[model samples]
Target: MGCILGRHDSFVYPTWHSDPLSWSSPLDSRRGPLPLSPSPQRGEGERHTRRRAPSPEGRGGQGVRTTRARRDGFTRKVLAWYARAGRDLPWRRTRDPYRVLVSEFMLQQTQVSRVQEYYPRFLARFPDLDALASARPRAVREAWDGLGYYARASNLHALARVVSRDSDGTLPAEPEELIKLPGIGPYTAGAVASFAYEKPVPAVDTNVARVLRRVFFGKRETRNGKREVWQLAAVLVPRNGKRAWKFNQAIMELGALICVARKPKCPGCPVRPVCRTGQSPVS
Candidate 1:
């Protein structure tokens, strides 16, 4: 398994160890690190496999272009961009499961800046599952003031109580298990699994969805194309849970900062050549 080199910033997520054999080696040494086995060589056919479905005129017996190479190129660009430009957030500072869980819950339908203010305070008040589970719902709600999304606060309280009682005061590390908790959906589950437990599940948020769609599918209209994007995301995550964490974060950061919804800074984008949407101005 190949290693993933994280960004230099102190707040960036920590470097993930994919395999014991490669653990001691430098992260930049890995070449063509595929989330799946036997990383594929860079080529045209492989690069175009991820492009959009053929148009009606190009359908029938006509050959359809694959975007596999473009996907690989885009992935590399995004990863490189991520290594240099990923954000520094409080939750990313630690690999603690509780912190990741809290961050994920608070982040739903909320901005990172807003969540930042509430995160430390909430953690300070609850500290751990035991504290949260033992605290009154009203107290939890009080701590969640200004965060809005009252449902998140309520569900978090319910989740804490359940986790404390059922899991012996421990949060499950697996995505499947985490999904069983209140307020945890597929995205949150994948996030906690990858960010907290280093699982290889893909977490597709709005940013990731837009970036993947534009870079791989070349389709600006993703309103009805999320499923395909998610499938592609699943295929892109390395089987190694640790590397998956880096891959997931890198992609999300790319979407948030570079492959933005409007006037994407594609010129400076690492995956510019592979992107079918044309070159970015920043490049």
Candidate 2:
């Protein structure tokens, strides 16, 4: 387990914890801290066998030059960059599930600056799930006025109602369960789970997808490439939840600020040494 260090004016780093009670944010007593999927248990006395390592093609979803050392280096470089340049945003400060949900909903297809303007205002009006659930539909829509994609607001409202009524106002801490909520797709679910609950999961948005493809696959976007990108994302996520949170945020930040869709700023990229696109002579 890991704990978030003090809110630094510059960089924020995740520190490992021997005791979970020392965590920066209080954990849900019921669900506890969710972990990555468990490995299959092996029976005692089973004969050990050595098998040939899989070829690059056989190791699907991993990076182009995937290896323990390579992966660890990649993680280190990204975190170091984040330490130097990660943005201090409103959503990154809290572990409250309700606030995370609202932020994720508001951030969909919206710029960070715009979300920054609207997030606090929306939370001031409807502070929690119960408040959002009890609000009138028109009011919710009105709060989301300038933030295009009105359907997201409606879905978030519906999700709040369902959670309040059926789940006793407790938002689920797991991505699998979070996905069941209205308006929350895979990416949003992962975002809320990892960001709010510190679950070790990948949150792949357009920026994340772009970074993963260029760094790992070294190719332009394709309809068939999404599955591989997600696989690489999942494989690359840190096992520690708090570290994973920083990793996900760092990668997304890298994509947004450096790996722009048009003419990426590769000269300043931190992970350019290991990135396929960055290393390419043509790129």
Candidate 3:
């Protein structure tokens, strides 16, 4: 139950599994879809078998890989869970960068229900980046009236104009390029890149960050702990772009629906077995 810190002071917890694929669950796809609600906790007598996992570098030291042991199993479990439980939202159905961009902009500092109400309506008014760029600022603001973050509206408009003019109405596919656009930050940029372009990058929004902290770090982090979470996220993402897209969305969805900000349903979480916090006595 000891802990170690990397050179950057990011916490890495040891896991017991020797083979990432060795772990199996009754929730396997062959059996059936997972129930919507979490199952009850196990009896006190039941516990997982333990075996020391090898470090990424094959030797332990200050620079040991944080995600080496957990990455494959963690990604597999989350992706499998998502295949069964993920919501079929409108934005999730498309790879259109403009549509994804709009969703990201509306989703910032706003609730998903409200965004659902306004998303189709706004998209109906301005169908693409060109349409948004061509519309007057007043019209754009009017479209964004209920979303509340008026500045996001302004920034979205600015971004549309910039991208429309410069990129020939196509949004950038890299986080680095996307971040340069208006209203888009690291999270939004990564979202756009992965969701739209299937880029294998990390997007550490509030929900994703919480899941990463509790599951990987095994404790609550300070408000400024986002950088460490982002690092962990980057390391954990699958190298394959398609799998990475699913991984990114799966983690975010897990955070929003199961591993919520308060009263996280750890008992039902797909990643619970490998999760530091979920496996801890306190959870």
Best candidate, TM-score-wise? 2
- Per-residue lDDT tens digits for candidate 2, residues 174-278, read 665665556655577678889999988777777787777787677654444655555566667887989999998998888778876777888888989988788
Model 1 regions more than 4 Å off:
1-68, 220-224, 280-283
lDDT of each structure?
0.62, 0.68, 0.67
How are the candidates ranked when ordered by lDDT, highest leading?
2, 3, 1
lDDT of 3 by residue, 203-268 (tens): 666678777777766675443344445546766777788998899889888888888766778778
lDDT of 1 by residue, 28-142 (tens): 1012121211112223133222222222121233322345565566566676777788787898887888888888878766767778888999999999888988998789989
Give me candidate 1's TM-score against the actual structure.
Answer: 0.73
lDDT of 3: 0.67
Q: CA shift at 24, candidate 2, in angstroms?
A: 35
How displaced is residue 42 in candidate 2, in Å? Answer: 27
Structure candidate 2, residue pairs in collision: none
In order of appearance, the predictions have TM-scores of: 0.73, 0.77, 0.75
- Residue 97 CA error for candidate 3 (Å)? 0.6
Clashing residue pairs in all predictions, respectively, total 19, 0, 0
Off by more than 4 A, model 3: 1-67, 220-224, 280-283
